[model samples]
Target: MSVTKKVILITGGSSGIGKAVGIYLSQKGYIVYGTTRNVANYSNFIHFPLLTLDVTKTDTIKKAVNDLIAKEGRIDVLVNNAGVGITGPVEEIPDNEICNHFETNYFGAIKVMKGVLPQMRKQKTGLIINVTSIAGYMGLPFRGVYSASKAALEVTTEAIRMEVMSFGIKVANLAPGDFATNIAGGRYHAPVIEGSDYQKNYQMSLDLMDAHVDDGGDPKEVGIIIEKIIQTPNPRIHYKVGAFMQKFSVFLKRILPDKTYEKLLLNHYKL
Candidate 1:
């Protein structure tokens, strides 16, 4: 292996879309470094290095960035893919739960980005891709907190893109629709909830989540699209990738009036 191949590091690469992205990028001749909390249990893949990293820890981010720099000399791309989801009414979710959600999904990405930005600035060429969600665009019932976190990520990426454009650093957002990822299965909930308060709303949220699993797109397909975006001469600010129907939803939201859009969402949720 070359001392330094087209290097890229991805967080939360243990499974689902992150794992698929690692595999696809490695197959395409890019040296891929994936970070996850568990390094012992993993599939064997050629030319892909799995590192142990806890995104919420600043120390872990610093060490991981330094290790990559020492080994590869230059980091080319950093994909902020680590995140968690919480589903419930805003009032029902404890304040601490909201903070924890942002800790992993928003601030964790910031920590990694802060550590790597200095190195990229020194080199004057790099790409930072933040994995946001379609919910970033429009809020969903029972998903207000998750949507807020992703929306924050999107806005942060836009600001970073502007600030780094002149320095040859690119920042882009990937707003994916529902996909077959562990996002639903691996979600964390507030311990405060005991299934009594807001039971009806909570039940509706659970039903919607189940429906998403049934209708989600394949992670491998989204992985392929990420590869294409990385290879493009100039990547867009945001890439919306998923089934054609999801694209149609974006179109509908754009064309429909505010009341009409609200009605559509209400109908979908049977509210």
Candidate 2:
């Protein structure tokens, strides 16, 4: 390995968008280190080196960063791509599950960011790309918690960008609308109560969400977008990847009245 090659660390690279991005970047000549909770299970499949890391655990995150720094000397880019989805009506969703959702989707990203910042600051040049979701901009039906978690991440990314700019460390949020992945399988759903009013609607909304993901954009496209961002001299703070409507929806939400936007969302989800 060339010492001059940039070292990139991406979390949750065992599958889906993360894996695609990791493989793509590695192929582009960057030294990529993708992290997963269980390296043993995915060691054979992952193309790049896999580091054992559970972003939800601070100790594990720190250890992963240290391990990478020890071998690579410096990390040039850190992509916070590990996340989970949870679906349910707010009233019916358990508090603990919501907490877990935020722990992985929001706080876990922050923990990894913190772990990598020290090294980035020492180097005085680095990039942090957080993989959020378009749902962050507009809360989707039944997927309220997941939307909220990503929303929180988007806001945090903004603040971190301003704070780290002086250090020559750039931060950006890549809000992908929908990409075909196994995320549907890992998503947490609220249990339907026998007589709960939301039971029927909840199921409908969950199905709609799953269908969108099933017919979503390709994960390789997202990987290409990430690669472009990496190659750019200075990337924007927010990048949206998906179909035209998905990206336009964010613009529409910005200009449309509150009720009008809500109505559009309701109609789209068939709620």
Candidate 3:
């Protein structure tokens, strides 16, 4: 691969937004490297490259970085897109459940960042786009774990952006709203089953959560926005991607008082 061509490494690129972005970027002349847990059952419009990686595994991350460097000579962009959500009340969530969420969503991104930062600094030109979510901006009840993980990622992105500017390495985050993806199926299920003390409320919350997941917009829209951001000369620090929910959430938090906003959310969720 030519070093002059844009080389991008995307985690969780096997399907959904990541895969869609890979197809689009490949068509646009980027040498895209995508990572997935399952490299066997793959089908796509393009035949770029697929690397096997379980984001929680540090050795896998190191191997991917080393392999990419050896083959491409340099990486121009790294998209930290591999993440999983775990939704439940803080009280009801088990210690292991919380750790699992952090393992993939928070630390997985950090691991990839750490592995790539040295190379980016050495090259003095690179871009890191973290696939965070609108949940990063606000903490929604029952989805505390997911929101907190994304929130941490957003903060890390901001801090790194400030620190890496002199190196000409840009760090930007895409905070997408609800999108049609398998993320819900991929989310960690809290170990606390039914009939426990928190069961009634948790069950109610689960039902409400189901409603929101069903209301998701298309993942293709998010994919197109990501492509645009990548192709832009200078991307913003953070962008909210999706339909009116993106704007409405920010407005609700900024304009409405806390109690009022809570009530509105409760009414919307039918809680």
Candidate 4:
């Protein structure tokens, strides 16, 4: 592949936002490498080269990073986008599911950073963009697990920005609102058990969640925002991308009274 202004590594790049980012950046002339859990599965389908990297597995992370650096000499950007979606009433969600959710969405992202930060530090310049979500800004009704996991990443990125600034590495969190992607199909939804207190509300949320994704904006919009962030000289600590109301929800939570905001959420979810 021909080189460009930057070499970007995007995890979970095989599909959804990750795939969109790879395609957009590659078209814009950036050398882009996307990672998937299994490269063989996407060999015939992907537009760009994909590396085998499972964020939950340290060995795979190390191999993917090493292989990239060995080929590209240095990595100028790392987009920690590999993550899975989980949604359910916090009370009913199984412990294993929660653990697995954090394993991929939160811990997996951190490990990916650990794999690439060393190379970035050596180069003395790099950008790490952690893809979070607008839902992270508030505790959504039944999406408690999903909100918490993304929120964790957002908070961690804030601290990481400070710690790595001296090393000339910039860390930022890009929280996208609902985007049209295959994420709905892959999400972990805790069983809507009969006779449970949350049965009705949980089912309503699950349906709403899927509907939102189906009606969400194009995934490439995220790539557009990411490209802008890459072009920026000193990118901000946090960025949001999505529809008017979805992003506005975040701002609303900040300015509105606590109970007022809770009421607004309750009304939206039809609880």
> What are the root-mean-square deviations of the candidates from the true structure over C-alphas?
2.6, 1.6, 2.6, 1.5
TM-scores vs. true structure, each candidate: 0.91, 0.96, 0.90, 0.98
**lDDT values for all models:** 0.83, 0.90, 0.83, 0.92
- For model 2, give the RMSD to the true fold: 1.6
Top model by lDDT, which number?
4
**Steric clashes per prediction:** 0, 0, 0, 0
Ranking by TM-score: 4, 2, 1, 3
lDDT of 4 by residue, 57-91 (tens): 99999999999998989999999998988878888
Candidate 3 residue lDDT tens string, 1-271: 3432689999998877787778777777888999987687675535579987888888888888889999988888998999887877788788888988898999989998988888999999889999998878777777888999999999999998999999989889998887777777877767546577766767777776666667878777766777777777678998888769665787678888989988877776566
Number of clashing pairs, model 1? 0
Cα error of candidate 2 at position 15, Å: 0.6
Model 1 per-residue lDDT tens digits across residues 1-271: 2423668999998787888888878777788999987677665644378887888898888988899999989888888898888888787788888899999999999898998999999998888999998888888888889989999999999999999888889889998888877777788654435567767667776878768866798887766777777777689998888777676777888899989998988888777
- For model 1, what is the alpha-carbon lDDT of residue 270? 75
User: Hey, what RMSD does candidate 1 come out at?
Assistant: 2.6
Model 1: colliding residue pairs: none
Candidate 2 weakest lDDT stretch, 10 residues: 1-10
Badly placed stretches (over 4 Å) of model 1 are 1-4, 41-47, 190-197
| Candidates sorted on lDDT, descending | 4, 2, 1, 3
lDDT of model 3 at position 40: 75
